[model samples]
Target: MPADPEPTAAAAANAAESDGAFASPTPELWQALGWAPDDNQRAQFLALQQQLREWNGRLNLTRLVEEADFWIAQVVDSLWPLLPLLRERPEAPLRCIDVGTGGGFPGLAVAIALPNARLTLVDSVGRKTQAVQAMAEALGLAERVELRCERVELTGRQKRCRGQFDLALARAVAAAPVVAEYLVPLLASGGEALLYRGQWSDDDQAELDRALALLKARVSRREQRELPAGRGLRTALTLQPVAPCPAQYPRAVGVPAKLPLGA
Candidate 1:
C-alpha cells in the first residue's frame, strides 16, 4: 500500500472550520485508543464522506450521509472496534475481508486508517460494490482494496479467498450464527473474525457457540462500547479458529441466512 497523501490547504481549512457534531472527536476518544489520524488520514476521511454523499443519492448506499451522523455512526463506529489491533500493531501488513460490506463501512474506513492492510470488500449487490470501488479509487485506495460483488458464501468457497485472510469482519450482516458461518470459513488458521453487532445477549452467545463448534472455532474475546451521544451499545466479538473449518460451511448462497447454524 502507498503512503497517505499529504493534506492539502483546502482540507486543513475544512477541518479547522468544522464545528459541533460535524467536528472530529475530541482528543480523548482517539487518545484512549492510542491512535489518531494524521492530516493525510483526516483528508482521506473527508474525501470518503464526500464520495458517500455524492453516490448516495442514486445508489441509496446509506442514510447516514449527514456530516455528524457519518462521523459517529459510520467512521467512529467502524474504527472503535479495531482499537486492540490498531494499538498493538498499527502497521501490520494484514489481509482483511469485509463480508456483506454494504456501502463499505468498516472496510473503506479501515483502508484509510491502516495503510499497510489490504482489503477485500464483498457485497452481494453489484451496485453497492461498484459504488464502493469508485469510492476506494477516489480515495487513492484502489491499489490496496479489492471489490467482490458476490455472496459471501460463494466467496468463502472460492479457493482464492477461502482461508486466505488474517482478519474477517462483518457488521450488521446477519444473526451471529449465520455470520460465524460466513466469516469462519474465510479465516486462515490463527486468524481472527470480528463480528460487529448493535446488541448482544446471552442467547446470542449461546447460538454462536454452537455454530463455532461446527466451524472448529471459539470466541477469543468480546467487548462492548457505548457509541458517543448515546447512539447505542456496540459489541465486538472476536473468534479464533481452533482447527480448519469444514469445507461444507457457508452452506449455499442463501442457506446461512435462511437456516443459520445452530438453528
Candidate 2:
C-alpha cells in the first residue's frame, strides 16, 4: 500500500483539536471497560480517531465520527467483548484476526490495548484495507498488524490462515449464523470467535444454534450490556469450535451473507 501523505499544518492543527475534543472519553472508557490504556495506548486511540476523521470523507469508512459516538460506539464497543481475555492474559502474544475489519475498529483497538497481540485484519475492499494499513502505520502498530485485502471466506480457507488465530472477531458483519461461518473456521484449537452484535433476540440465538451445529461449534459464553449513555444494547457471543470445521465451511465469497448458514 502507498504511504499516506505527511499531514499539512492545518491537518496537524485539526488533528490536535480533534484530540482535545475527544480527550475526556479516555477515563470514561477506562471505567466502562474496567481496563485502562497506558499513556501510549491512549495516544494511539486518539490517533485512530483522527485517522478515521481524515479518511471517512474519502472512503466513507464509518459514520460514528462524533466524540462520544466514536468513543462509546467504536472504541468501547470493540474492546468491551475482550475484557475477560484482556484481564486473563494481558501480555500474551495472542494471534487474532478481525474479519470484515472496515476501518479497523476492534482490531486496531485490540492491538493498542493488548500491546503484544498480532492482528490480521481482513476486509474485501481494497481502499478500506489500504486506509487501515496507513492508520496502523501511523499508530506504530504496523509491525504487529497484518492487512489482508480479500474476502474473509477466502482467508478462512487459506492454509496459512485457517485454524491459526487465538481469537477471531466479527462485529456487525452479518447475521449471527453468517458471522459464525466467517469466524469459526479461522480459529485454532481452543481459540474463540467473538461476535459483537446489537439487540440480540431469542430468534437470533435459535438461528445461531443451528448454524453452530453445522459449523461444529458451540456457544461458550454470551453477555449483554447496555452501552454507556444509553447508546443502545450490545451482545457479545463467544463460540468455541467443538471439532474441526468442515472443509466446506464459509461456503463462498458471497454465499454466507446471501444464503446465511442454517437459514
Candidate 3:
C-alpha cells in the first residue's frame, strides 16, 4: 500500500491547536477550493467572519451566515476567482474592485482571503460602505482596502479610480449586462470581470455580449458548479476587456439597472 499523504494545512493547524496555542484553521473550507490558508491568513479570515456576524444586525450583511452556508457561499465563492486568475497569470499583482459590493461579500472576503490583493469595495449604500470601512481598519487593512460609498457609475467617472483595477467582481448584484457595465469601466486595459450568478440563460448571455461590446469587453470563459452540502447552483462568467471602456460607459446611476444595455 502507498504511504499516507502529508497532512493538509488545516490538519497541521488542528494538530498544533491540540498541542500548543495554534488556533483552529478552516482547512476544509479552503481545501474544497484547492487552496490553503496559513495560520495567519486563517486568523484573519476567522476575524473577518466574526466581524461580519456582529455587524449583521444593521448591515444585514450576509444571508449565508449559518456555518455551512457561510463557508460555501461567502468564503469559497469569494476566493474561487483568485485561483483561476493566479493559475492563468501567475505573476500579476492584483488591484481589484468589488462593484455594488453591498455588505462586501466577495470584496471584503477577497481582502481577507488574498491579503496581497488590494481591494476597493464600492457600494451605493452609505451604511454598508461605512461598516466595511470600519471593519477594514479594524483588521489592519485600511491602507490596502478602500470602501467607496457611491454609485458605480460615479467611480468610473473619477480619473483616479477608472481603469486602475486588474480584476473586478460583483456577486448577486444585478443582471449580467448591468454588472458588466459597472465593472468594465473600472478595469485597466486587459482587466477581467467575474460576474457571479445563480443561473445562466441565453438571453442573459446575448444581452451581456451586446453590452460588453459597447464597453469593449467580451465573455472569455464561463464555469458552473454546485456548492457542496446542497448549498445550490452557481456560475461565474469571466469577461476580458479587449480594449479600454469608452469614456461614455457606465452611463449614469440607475441607467444600467433600468435600461440594462444588453438586455
Highest lDDT scorer: 2
Residue pairs with colliding backbones in model 1 are: none
TM-score of each prediction = 0.89, 0.89, 0.85
Q: What TM-score, to 2 decimals, does candidate 1 have? A: 0.89
Query: What's every prediction's RMSD, in angstroms?
Result: 8.5, 9.8, 7.8
Error of 2 at 248 (Å): 0.9
Clashes of each: 0, 0, 0
lDDT of each: 0.85, 0.86, 0.76
How far in Å is the alpha carbon of 193 misplaced in model 2?
0.1
Q: Which parts of model 1 are misplaced by more than 4 Å? A: 1-34
Local lDDT at 223 for model 2: 83
- Model 2 poorest 10 in a row by lDDT: 1-10
Question: Which tens-of-lDDT digit does each residue in 1-263 have in candidate 3?
Answer: 12223335665455334321112235555555667766776777778777888888776877766566566667777777667654454445589899888767888777766667888898988988988898888788898898888888899899888999888899888888888888888888777889998767777778888988898888888877655444455777888999878888889888988998855
lDDT of 1 by residue, 103-140 (tens): 99899999988989999999989999999999999999
Candidate 3 yields a Cα-based lDDT of 0.76
**Model 2, 1-263: lDDT tens per residue?**
12222335655555444444443565645786678888888888888889899999898999987776788788889998888777888899999999999989789999998999999999999999999999999999999999999999899899999999999999888889999999999999999999998876678889999999999999998887765654566888999999999999978889998998888
